[model samples]
Structure formats: C-alpha cells, structure tokens
Target: MSLLNLAWHSLWARRGTALLSLLTIALSVALLLGVENLRTQAKSSFASTISGTDLIVGARSGPTQLLLYSVFRIGNATNNISWDSYQQITQQPTVKWAIPISLGDSHRGYRVMGTTNSFFEHYQYANKQPLRFAQGRALENTYDVVLGAEVARKLQYHLGDKIVVAHGLAAVSFVNHEHYPFVVSGILQPTGTPVDRSVITSLAGIEAIHLPPQQQAYSEQQLTPSSITAMMLGTQSKLQIFSLQRQINEYKGEALLAILPGVALQELWGILSIAESALLAVSICVVITGLMSMLSTLMVSLKERRREMAILRSVGAKPRHIFGLLLLEALLLSVLGALLGLLSMYLILAAAKPLLLSQFGFYLVLTWPSLQQLYLLLAVVIVGFIAGVLPAWRAYRYSLSDGMSIRI
Candidate 1:
C-alpha cells in the first residue's frame, strides 16, 4: 500500500481521538474567521451609513457624540439647533442643499424623525445611492408619515394606518400624543442602514403635535419647526467644503458643531479599536490551544503505535517513510478541520443575515472567503505541519525490536 493509504488506515484505527482533535481545530478556526468578518464589515457599514452629505451640523457637542446621535440615532442631542440658524447657514453660497432633522419622539422602540421633502430628494447612503420607496409616496400633508422598512414590518403597518407618537424614546410611553396621530403615507426600501429603524414625518407634524391644542390646523407657513436636532449640509464644490465647515463652526447665532462624517467615523472606530484588538487576540489564543490539543493527541497515540511501527519495519519500510506517514496524518487532519470550519462559518452567516439586517440594520455580504481569510487558512496548515515534527521524529527513531515482543 502507498504511504497515504497507510496513513489513512492508521487514522481510521484511532478515529475517536482524531475526531475530537479535528473538532477542536475546526471550532477554533471558525471563531477566528468570524471575528475578522465582523471587524471588516462593521467599519464598512458605519462608513457607508450616510454618504454624499458633506457635513453634519448639530448642537454644540463632541464630534463623536454628534455623529452618533445625528446619523446612528444612538443618543439624544444635548440641545436643539434653532430654525433661524438652519436657515442662515443654508443660505450660504457654498451650501448646495440641506436636510433638517428634528427628533424627540418615538413609536414603540423606534425613533421618530421630522424632516422635509428635501430629505427624500437629497439623502444618500451606500456610495451616494438615493433613497428609494418600496410603497406609496413621500409626505404630502402635515399628517402624513413615512415608515422605514423595519418599522413597517415589525409593526405590521401599511398606508393609511394611524400611529400614535409618544413623547420620549421609551418603547412604552404614558405621555403619548394620542390626540395627534399621523397616517402612514409611504414605506422606504431597506438600505441595510440605521434609517431602517426610523419613523419619518414632516416638520409640520412634529410642530403640531407639541403645540397647544385649539383649532389644530397647520399650513405650509406654520410648518417651520421651532428647533431641529441637526442638519445635513451638502456643499456646491468639494473645494469649498473646508471653508463652509469653518464658517459654520465660527457662527455667533448659536453654539453649533460642524463635522465631516468621514472624520467622525474614523474617530469612532479609533475609540472602538481596543475592544476589537482584544477580541482578535482571544481568537488567536483559541486557535493555538486547538493546535496544542492536536499535538497532545498525536503524542499519546505514539506509545500505542509501537507494535504497528515494528510491523512496518519488518516489511522493509525505511525510517523516512515512517516519518513521512506521521506528517501526512497531521496534515490531512488539519486540512479537513479547516474545511469543516469554513462550512460552519458560512452556515452561521447565512442564518444571521436576515436578523442582522432587520434588527440592527447591518447587512453582511455573503461571499466566498476573502484573501485575508485565505491567508489565515494557509497559516493553519503551516502550523499543523510544524506540530507534526516531534511525533514524526519519535516514530522514525523506534527500533524493530521495540514492539516485536509483546509486553506482559
């Protein structure tokens, strides 16, 4: 029989221990690759959440805080930007278009944003892609509201369904504007971004809900909000972006912050880098532990294989052949383990795609292993070969007399 066939028979004889060792390596590789997938995709998601807009102008606050509130809807603004400030800034020669964002209310757990028709027309995501509607049309009246894909799906809302807005971010609120419910007019297409969780309404709808009750009728002139949470500004020229940002920062009317979304995203990632590194380190340690387990299995099986080695020697098999056989077993086990690990990873990702996109608005592209992942697989094979060196040497050194006679 060939060396490979001999190696296969030897492993099959010790299948229980070999299987356990293989599983350890497989689980370890899955964990390492999973961590890498999350890290790279998270950065890409955050960067593409909002694109095309040149600046995010919000109430004076830390750049990261502003970005988190304005774009991600993670937190509330420290203060509101007055309508006067929004108008004056947008009037600048360099300001090409602006989208106002007024926030404070919620329906269920989803945030409510008050914006203009400008938002539907100008807002972009995922490489300057325009927002698309999956149902109905944009806001046409003060009482009309648009639903994000997730919001509509989770709430089972459709056009003309009236939803009551609550005063705060809590899922269950006691102070609901039950008297000022808005009818759903449209549902936005899923963009796999944070916007999927937002409930959109016109600026007039927000203003009317908070205003004192009377003959509750609002017109286009009265649609102007008293203050807004933030403004996304687009500049006419890329060259004028810096100049416009500086101008907004130095404005005297109100304390306002203007931040480039890209810069804020980088800073946010920098803040999160430590946690990401720690996760990666832990994954590497797990992979090493798995390799160590395989080594231990090989070491223990050595003593049991002494009689088998004696028979091979009697058959005129050289010490070099014995060494090569042991090496081949280890290589085969690792290669199988890596393949199993890759299959498990893809299955997990496939199952998680819908949940991630719906709940977190995070979309992970399901693709074949990346170059970096391939490198990791290559590294595992190299380490597996190195792990076989000790056992291969020991097996080669065994003498024919060692196991020719049975021990009592």
Candidate 2:
C-alpha cells in the first residue's frame, strides 16, 4: 500500500481515540488564543479612550483614582471644583477650550455626564475621532439630554422622549426631581468608549436636577448646590499642559488635583499589570498541557500497534512506510485542531466586540494572527513532530526485530 493509504487506514482504525484527542487539542488551542486576544484588545481599548485630552482635573486623589472616576467612570469623586475655579482656568492665555464634566448619576446602570456642546466638538477617542451624532444634535437647553449609542439602544428611547433625572445613581430614587424632566434631543454615534454608555447633558442640567426644592417663602435662604464630579481640560499649546497641571495642583482656593490623562492612564494600567501577566502565564500553561496530552496519547497507542506493525512488515511494506504513517497522523490531526480553534476564536470575538467596546472602551480588531501568534503555531507543529517520533521510532525498531516472523 502507498504511504497515504497506510496513514489513512491507521488513523481510521483508531478513529474513536484519535477524534477525542483532536477535540482536546482543539479546545486548548482555542483557550490559549482567546485569552491572548482579549489581553491585547483590552490594553488597546484602555489606552485609546482618552487620547487628545491634555489634562484631567478633579478633587484631591491619586492619579489612578482620578483617572478611574473621570475617564473610565469606574468610581466616584470625593469633591468637585467650584464653577469660579473652572472659569478662572479656562480664561488662562494658554487655554484653548475647556470642557467640564459633571458626573454622579446614572440611567439604567450607565453614567450621566453633564458637559457643554463644546465637548462634542472637541473631545476625541481612538485616533482623535470626533464624536458623531447618530440622530439629532447636542443639547442646547438645560432641560435637554443626549443619549449615548448604547443608552439609546438599551433603553429604546427616541428623540423628544421625556426622561426623569433621579436624585442619585440608584434605580430606585425617593427624591425624584419630577419637575425637571429632560427631553431627548440627540443620540451620539457609537465611539467604542465609556462615553457610548453614558447619558450626556448640559452642565446646568446636572445642577438643576440636584438643586433643592424651594418653598415659595424662602427667597433669602442660601442654596447649597451639589458638588460637580470631574472635568477634562484642553489647551491651546501642548507645552502648557505641565504648567497648567502644576497650577491646578497648587491652587490654595480648593482641595483639588490635576493630572495628564495619558500619564494617569499608564499608571492605572501599571496597577492592573499583574492581572495581565497572570492571564499570559495561564495561556502558556494551557498550550503546554495540550501538547503533552497529544504526545502521551500517541505514545500509549504505539504499544498496542506493534502486532499490526509486524504484519505490515510481512506484507513487504518498508519500515519507512510505518514511520511515515504515524507522522502523517500527527500532522493531520494537529492542523485540523488548529484550524478549528482559530475559527472558534473568530466567532467569539465577533460576538463580544460591541459589548467590550461600549462597556470597557475597547475596540478589538479581529484578523489573522500576528507574527508572534504564527510563531506559536509553528511551535505547536514542531511539538506534534516531536510527539510522533517515539511512535514512529518504535514501529521502525519492531520491523527490524520481527524479520518476517509470525511471532506475537
């Protein structure tokens, strides 16, 4: 028989076991590739969210904390800068334009960010791309609101719908400001950032909703306004960022801090670096375990195939034929497993990309594996070759020893 026929027959004789082995290898490959892809895209997403902004100014806190609250909307701010200070900073000669962010409320688990129309004009993400409107425009009045793409899709609200501003971020609010409902004026296009999951409005709208109800008789009583959350500042000159940051940090008027958004984001990733490392280590282990399992299974099956090998020798088949059969089985099974794993990975990433981007500000690029990934695949093939060697070697040795005998 030809080498191809011998290899085919050998695999078919043990189809049950071979198929199981292939499945296990395929699953392990999928796990390794999936984790690596997630890690890479997550880092890209985190880093892309706040590009182009010079500084993030907020109440006193660590740089990472400020980034989490202001940029990622991951936590709450302890204090807010007064409107007077905000105005003073914006008037600086080095300042080009400023966009203040007032946050503290949420609509159905998404954050509410109150800013000016300038925000849509100036704020950028993922390669400095401006926020595009899917429907309508930015809010012109304090009573108007603009929903992010995710918020619009999730809530099913269209333009001109009335939405209530709650007292706090909770779903159940006892202090509902029913008197100051906002009209949905616009819905922003998807930007693959936390902004896509937020409710946007004018700064005054945030203030108005939080303002205490006034009794008809209390004209003279001083009103204590709710503190604003955070602000993102843009400058005319890139060189002025450090100076402005220093000024904001040293201001004697209020307890506040300012940071370069890019720097703070890097610091935040440093803090989360351990999680990334752990994921990488786990993937490597999975790949190693997968290769070992394939090797062990092939080696075990060789012991039972010795009689079959001797019979082939009696039928005038060369020892090289038996060796090629074992090696071919290893190559065929491994390549199939790898292809299946890659396909499964593509399907999963396609499904999860939108959710990942909106929720975590990560835009995953799904494409062929990178050079490093290709090298890893090549290593897997090399591992298969090594695994097949012992079985092929045993078959060759048996052929020389049997010498046409019908011995067991």
Candidate 3:
C-alpha cells in the first residue's frame, strides 16, 4: 500500500481518538481564522462607514470621541458647535460641500439625526456610494422624517406613519414630542453602517420639536438651527485638507475639532488594540492546546502500535519507511483538520451575519481566506508535523523481536 493509504488505515484503526483530535484541531483553526476575519472585517466596516467626505468637524473633543458620536452614533457629543461656526467654516475658499448634523434624540431605540437635504446629496459610504431610498423621496418638508432600513423593518413603519420623537435614547422615555410628530417621508436602503439604524429628519424638524406648541407651526426656510452636533465637509482640494483642518481647529468663531475620518478611524482602531491583542492571544492559546492534545493522542497510540511496528519491520520495512508512515499520518490529520476548520469557520460567519449586523452594525461578508489566515493554517500543519516527531521516532526504534513476546 502507498504511505497515504497506510496512514488512512492506521488512523481508521483508532478512529475514536483520531476523530477527537481532528475535531479539536478543526475548532482551533476555525477560531484562529474567525479572529482574523473579525479584525479585517471590522476595519473594512468602520472604514467604509463614511467616505467621500474629507473632514468630520465637531465641537471640541477627542477625535475618536467625535467619530463615535457623529459617525457611529455610539455616544452623545460633549457639546455642539454653533450653527454660525458651521456656516462660517463651510464658506471657506477650499470648501466643496458640507452637511450639518444634529443628534441626541431618538425614535424607539434608533438615533434621530437632523440634517438638511444636502445630506442625501453629499453623504456617501463604501467607495463613494450614495444613499438610495428603498421607498419614498428625500426629506422635503419641515415635519418629514426618514427611516433607515433597520428602523423601518423593525418598527414596521411606512411612509406617512407619524413617529413620536423622544428626548433621549431610551426605548420608552418620560418626555415625548408627540405634538410635532414627524411624518415618515422616506426609508433608506441598508448600507451595513450606522445609517441603517438612524431615524432621520430635517434640521428644522429637530428644532421644531424643541419649540413651544404655539411655535411648532413653521416653515424650514424661516428656521435656523442655533447649534448642531457635527458637520461633514468635503474639501475642494484633497491636497489642502490638512491646512483647512488646521484653520477649522483654530477658528476664532468657536472651539471645534476637525478630524479626517480615515485618521480618526485609525485612532479608533488603536483604542481597540488591547482588546484585539487579547482576543488573538486567547485564540493562539486554544490552538496550542489543540495541537498538544493531538501530540498526546499520537504519543499514547505509539504504545499500542508497538507490535504493528515490529511486524512491519519484520516484513522488511526500513526505519525510514516507518518514520515516513507515521509522519504522513500526522500530516494527513493536519490537512484534514485545516480543511474542516475552514469550512466550519465560514458556516459560523454565515450564521452570525444578521446577528452582528443587527446588534452592532457589523456586516460580515464571506470571502476567501486571507493570505495571513492561510499562513496561519500552514503553520498549524507544520506544528502538527513537528508534534508527530517523538511518536514517529519511538515507533522507528521498535525491533522485530519486540512483538514476539506479549506483555499483559
């Protein structure tokens, strides 16, 4: 028989132990690849969350914090920049287009962001992709609201449905601006970003909700937002973005922060470095444990195979052939485990897609294994080969006379 066939027969003789070892290694490989998947996908998701905009300007705060509140809508802003500052900055010689953003209210659990129609025209994500309406048109009236894909689907809301705006992020709030409920004029398609969970309204709608009941009747043209949560700016010249950012940061009109979304994303990722490292370390440890278990199984099996080794040697099998056979068995198990692990990893990701998107706005897409992940699997195979050395050597040392007498 060929070495591959012999290895398969040898493993089949100890099917239970071999099966367990294969599963353990497979799970380890899956976990290792899963971590890598999360790392790369997270970067992609966050990086693609906002694009085409050159600068995200907000009230004075940490760049990462501003990114969290303005783009990700994770937390409340420290303060809001004045609308006057917004107008002033947008008029700079290098400004291309700007969208004003106001936040801090919600419908049900989704964030309520206030901005002009400019938002629809200027905002982009995932390679300058513009927002498309699944149904209805963009915000056109003062009391008009736009429901994101998740909000519309989860709430079962449609165009013309009036939604009460709550004062805070709670599902049920003590204060509700029911008097000036917003009519859902549009629903945005899913972009796999924070926008998918937002409840959007015109800037005037946000301000109107704050006004007294008597003053609620208004035209958007007559209303001016006194303050806004943040602003997204597209520069006229990509080369002068840094200079404009410096100018915005030093603006005499107000204390503000200007951040390049890409750099701030890197900073946000830096904040997650510790957690990422911890997760990676834990995955590595699990893989090590799995490999160790395989090694233990191989070593224990060598004792039971002493007679088989003796018989093979007697049948004219050289030490080299014995070594090669044992080594091939380890290689076979490793290769099978790696392949099984890859399949399991993709399955898990597929199952986790909706949950991750719903819970954290993380959209998982299955792609081929990254080069790094392939190298990791390759390394696992190498380790498995090395792990088989002791048992292979011990089996190679077996003499023909060893199987002549049996030990109870």
Candidate 4:
C-alpha cells in the first residue's frame, strides 16, 4: 500500500487519541476565529451607530466622554449647554438642521432621550438609513413618548401605554415622575445601535415631566428648554464642517465643545485596543497549546509504530517516504480541525445571534470565512507540519538503523 494509505490506516487505528487531539485543535481554532469575528462586527456596529451628522456639540469635556454620553448614552454629560446656544448654532446659515438631546432620565435602566421630531426625520444609521417606525408615529403631543425596539420588548410597552420616567439614570430610581406619566406614541424598528436601548420623547415632554405639579400646567411655547445635554448638527456642506465645529467650540454664549463623531468613535475604539490585543494574545496561546497537544500525541504514537515503519522500509519505502507519511498525517489533522472549527463557529454564532441582539444590541452576521480566517487556517496547517517534522525525522532515523528488523 502507498504511504498515504498506510498513514490513514495508522491514524484510524489510534482514532480515540487522534480524535481528542483533533477536538482540542478545533476548539482552539473556533475561539480564535470567534474573537476575530466579534471584534470586527463590534467595530462595524459601533461605527454605524450614527451617521450623516457632521458634529456632536456638547459641554466642554473629553471627546470620548461626550461621544459616550451623546451618541451611545453610556455616561452622563459633564455639563449641559444653554438652550440659547443651541438655537444660535442651529440658526447658522451653514447649518442645515440640528437635533437637540436632553438626557439624565431612565425607565427600567433604558435611557430616556428628550429630542424633537427632527430626530426621527434626520437621524441616520447603518450607512445613512433613516429611522423607521415599527408601530405608531413620532411624538405628536406634549405627553407623547417613543420606545425603542428593545425598550418596548423588555418593558412590554405598547402604543397608548402610560409610562412614568425616573429623574435619574438608574434602573430603580427613588424619584419617579408619576404625576406626569407619558403615553407611548411610537415604537422604533430595531437598528442594532444604542438607539435600540433608548426611550425617546419630545423636548416638551421632558420639560413637563421635570416640572413641579403646579408648573406642569405651563404651555409648551412658554416653557422654553433652559438647557440641553447635546446637539447633533448636520452642515449644509461637508466642507463647512470644520468651520462650524470651530465656531461651536469658541462660542461666546457658553463653554461648548464640538467633536467629529467618527473621530471620537475611533478614539474610543483605540482606548479599547489593548483589551482587544489581550484577547488575541490569549487565543494565540490556546492555539499554541493545541498544536503542542497534537505534537505530543504524534510523538507518543511513534514508539508503538516503530515496527510498522521498519516493515515499510523493508518494502523499499525510502526514508523520505516515512517522513512524508507522518507529516501528511499531521497536515490532515490540522486541516480537518480547522474545517470543524469553522463549522462550529457558525453554529455558535447562529444560536447566540438572537440573545446577543436582544441583550447587548449586537447583531452577529454569519458570512463565509474571511481572508484573515483563511490566513489563520493556513498558519495552523504550517504549524502542524512543522510540529510533525521532529517525530517524522525520529522515525526516519529509526527505520534507517533498524534496517530489516521485523520483530514486533
């Protein structure tokens, strides 16, 4: 029989041990590839959270902090900008439109955002895709509020449901605005962004809720918003972005800050780069451990297969043939492990997609293996071949010395 066939039968004879090694490599590969996939998808999801807006204008603070609060609702604003400043910036000739944001409220842990109808009209995500309503329409009355897809699902809220907002951004706030409860006017479609976890309402609704029971009777026109947390501005021309940003930053009315959302998002990602690198390093170590396991299995198997190699050598098999046999076996194992790893990754991603989207707003998309994954698989095969070389060489030397020794 050929060396290739002989190696195949030899592997089958020790299927139990060989299968264990294969599974080890497979699990390691799956973890490595899974990390890469999550990192890529997370970056993409983050970058697509907000689009079309030229700048995020907020209280003078760290760009990343402003981004966290304004765009992601991750943190509180250091300070709020005056309503007068928001009006002045929006009325600029270069400005096409602006959406004011008022934060510092929550309902069952989901952030409550106070903005205008322009928010639903101008806000964009995932390559400038406009927000679509899953049910009902944008806030039409002073007490109307909108619920994000996740918010509605988690809280079991529907249109016309009266929900009270809390004063603080906590899941169980002691201060609740039960006196001025809001009726759910709309529910937005899922966007796989921070918006999915937010509760949206009109600016007037925000003011009315915060007002005391006596002042709650004030008209929407009379109660001008005193201050807002942030504003997303869309410039008339892309060329005027820097000019507008600079003007907003150096405004005389308030100490405001303007940041390019994309730049701040990149900076935020850079801050997390160390964590990403650590994950990759850990995965690499696991992969190396798996390769070592494969090497150990092959080295241990060599002792029992010495007489088998000598028999092959007696049948005119060259030392190179014995070397190729062992090397090919290792390569086959690695290749099979890599294949199984990819299959398992897909299965895990498929099963977890719904849970991930619901809980973390992460939409994991399944696609064919990426080029990076291909390179990783190639690297595993190379490592496997190298791992086999020592045992293959040891067998070759034994075969040469044993000559025609057939005693098993």
Please, what is the TM-score per model? 0.96, 0.89, 0.96, 0.98
Displacement of the residue 21 alpha carbon in candidate 4, Å: 0.6
User: For candidate 4, what is the TM-score?
Assistant: 0.98
- Quality of model 3 by C-alpha lDDT: 0.89
lDDT per residue (tens digit) for residues 175-233 in model 2: 66787789999999887788878888887777666566563222212222344677788
Clashing pairs in 4: none
Tens digit of per-residue lDDT, candidate 1, span 132-249? 9999999998889999999999889998999999999999999999888999999999888888899999998998888766756766667678789999999999999999999999
Alpha-carbon RMSD, candidate 2: 3.1
Model 2 misplaced regions, further than 4 Å? 1-5, 212-227, 315-324, 351-364
RMSD of each: 1.7, 3.1, 1.7, 1.3
lDDT per residue (tens digit) for residues 370-400 in model 4: 8988998899889988998998898888777
lDDT of each: 0.90, 0.79, 0.89, 0.90
- Angstrom error of the Cα, residue 337, model 3: value is 0.6
Q: List clash counts for every candidate, in order.
A: 0, 0, 0, 0
* Clashes (candidate 2): 0
Cα error, candidate 3, residue 47 (Å): 1.0
Comparing 1 and 2 on lDDT, the stronger one: 1
